[model samples]
Target: MRSITSRRNVIMKAIVVFIITGLLTIPGYTLAGTSNISSNGTPHHPAFVESRDDLVNVQVAHRSSPSHPMAPNTADVNIIELLQQLNEPLILGYLENLTSFGPRETGTPSCDQAAHYIFDTFQNMGLVVRYHNYTDATVSGSNVEATLYGNDTTNIFIICGHYDSVAAGPGADDDGSGVAAVLAAAEIMRNYDFDHTVRFVAFSGEEQGLIGSYHYVQDAYNSNESIVAVLNADMIGFTATGSDGIVGKIFENPASEWIVSFTQDISVIYSDYIGIQLFPQGETWGSDHYYFWEYGYDAVFYHEYHFNDYYHSANDTIDRMNITYSTRFSRLILATLAQMAQQPVQQRPVLEISSISGGLGVTAQINNIGDANASDVKATILITGGLFNLINVQSTSEQTVLNAQGSMQSKAMVFRLGKILITVAADASNADQVTKQATGFLLGPFVLEVVIAP
Candidate 1:
């Protein structure tokens, strides 16, 4: 184990980093490797990938690997440690304070009180806080946003939950659980250093069909703000049955599956001691994430798996919630947000294409060129024959995950005659794809270069 010292000198929270050893296998899907070619070689690619679900499940081992599958890197471990700073008493206290304001209904004084409390809490954590006010025919309210700036100010990740609840009594479980989780995550992560900006947002008017989120996204989109991802927690305190019952649902869209899967992986690796289940399901409507998804950004939802019988009633108090379970959600979600915001100290992988014979094929070289490991790397080739006939081929002859300065080469497909140019596209993990092109004018071992900067 290594000692961690925050650059900001925010008192580091002591925590035990658990090293988990287990694998969850997906039932049906498997990555079937093959020679991937034909005699008159044109890459056999089923357009549109059939379904994104077939790609990968970060939680479960879609296939067996000799190395520790989905192992946590330094940043991941550090983020988990930071998330472990979440305490049940702290979250319970926030819940108590929030519920004390009574039902935070839109257009009500209670709603204003709740927003101010969230703003004050964020300010006390040394975060940049603001209130987004909007008005509609039926009601008007505010969305509170707090930002913990990272090295990169352009890329923003959000952890948002609604504070205003339905006209239902005190609205504790309806949204207080979610607000607590968001506040707790923000508090725990405040002292840490991140490479990407993270926003702790408390949305109002969610009960009125996600009004606050809608306005926020609309404003953000119009301003050309880049929202990398949104993780929304709602009603995570209540269990379906008794104290023994421990399960919650992680809902997501195709674009958001990666976030959901990454979160599920954290639940397994870092905090299984919570003895709770994270059931990932659905691609439909609900929560603040819904509006983000509607606007074509990546987003996910976290909620109690089973509907609470006492939800929206006066009986829905702190006593009715399983505080331990609620604490688990805060910890789990905080870890996810922390890990996503923590960019490891690594440069992006660079691609170089060498030994292009003009007619047959080309050797594509991919170098990690970074301190941290880069996984799930892929190199794709495209060639243009006569009169704009485009051909696609798999450039990577082998798997492309690379260590620091590690390099791997692949012999791409042998294109037919009259090929004008060969283009290679390379992407690793969460990094975007970069392309390099070579024209057939090459006479010697063709050298192609592509550099992806961090």
Candidate 2:
């Protein structure tokens, strides 16, 4: 548990972001999967949580964490080399070109030109690319997708951002930022080796209720595709204070909770570059991630931490955003995709915590159950329970290493309160860069708070 003052401070920051941001939803196509339904039988996307409003729950999710929630180790994994290939000048050029095309409104000629630019860019990267063109009575839009295949084609990992905007603005911040990330990631990641497929997509008609994503998901369902996850970025360049700070939210649904957790862990590993702050927003109404979540797929939504005041307006232009921030976010995107594509550890290290007797010192055991060496193994503990659950419970971390089939142990003295909860988490990585985490909770009889009637 955290202090009320600290929690309230974060929530105050979150209220401002939702007020002026365009979100992206995830998975759904013409597939046979069932959409989530509420008790009233109305179609509902299981909203996850709120931005900073749900930070407490987010902390709880990380409380019983996995060793390697993300397949590969949390190390840099050649991602920095790939990120180095990210040409900021090129990204600026792309944003400039995209913004100059004016508002790429759904079904407009301007939008089509932007589509051609992306399509051509992907071709130059030598990726397997194509166009997802959609038509309605009013307007037609094209969604550009580029593919970099890995050893496992069945497990498709997608990263995308909407390209279209409202008819009023240039949309440099609303979406051009995200599109810029996609463009940059594509150019750099094309040279990498991945174990799973990567699809870099630029969606159109997003301002008109995620039309392009909906259309693509429909076809994807009809084609019977294996979509492991959809990582969507929208409005990621807008930093209210305009510094190098990379403030953003990691949004996902209940089924996709792992995505959020994994992302938070990944961000910690790359905190120097991404600096991403997690706000587990369960119910996000707008953007591409919504559609993916609707269709029963694991998806994640990335957006700026602070909302842009000129959102969805003509004033939305490249000059208003911090391009350096976008560069860092794009770098994190490729790194995450590459990490997920890495091969899994056949022999994973398992960490366990046991022997809880309040003040009785707790023990954490690490077993390198995998066939490789586990390096930089760390175990952490946190205990909170006192008068009003506020006191110096216990917080400590220990580190070590374990070879194949080897085991180790660490113990920390814990204070026993009338009723307290203990959180034990361990993280370790194999020599091959495959990582894993183990977490457990020892709960004492403690009721948090009263539930109010809705």
User: What lDDT would candidate 1 get against the real structure?
Assistant: 0.66
Q: What lDDT tens digits, residue by residue, belong to model 2 across residues 1-454? A: 8899999988987975553221111111121222252321111111121232321111111111122324444567486677667756877888998998898887788888889998998999999999988985445788999999988777788899988877888899778988888888888878878887889999987766566787787677656676877889888776777442556666766556666766766777877766656666665646787766655456888777777788878898888887787777777776777677664513444343332322234444545555556678765544444434442333344455677677666555533223344444455543221112222232232222212111
N/CA/C clash count, model 1? 0
The C-alpha RMSD of each candidate to the native structure, in angstroms, is: 20.5, 17.9
Kindly give the stretch of ten consecutive residues in candidate 1 with the minimal lDDT sum. 60-69
User: For each candidate, what is the lDDT?
Assistant: 0.66, 0.65
Which tens-of-lDDT digit does each residue in 1-454 have in candidate 1? 3345563333322221111111111111112222332211111111212332432222210110011113244345576567557888989999999999987788899889889999999999999999999986656889999999999887788998889876668878778998998998888888888888899999887776677887898788767676777888888888767743567777776546667677777777675544566876756465667667656567888877777778667787888888888898788788777777874422334333333433334665766554456677776655444223333334454464667567766555442333346666666664434456666522212323322211
**Candidate 2: worst-modelled 10 consecutive residues by lDDT:** 55-64
Best by lDDT: 1
| Residue 379 lDDT (model 2) | 54
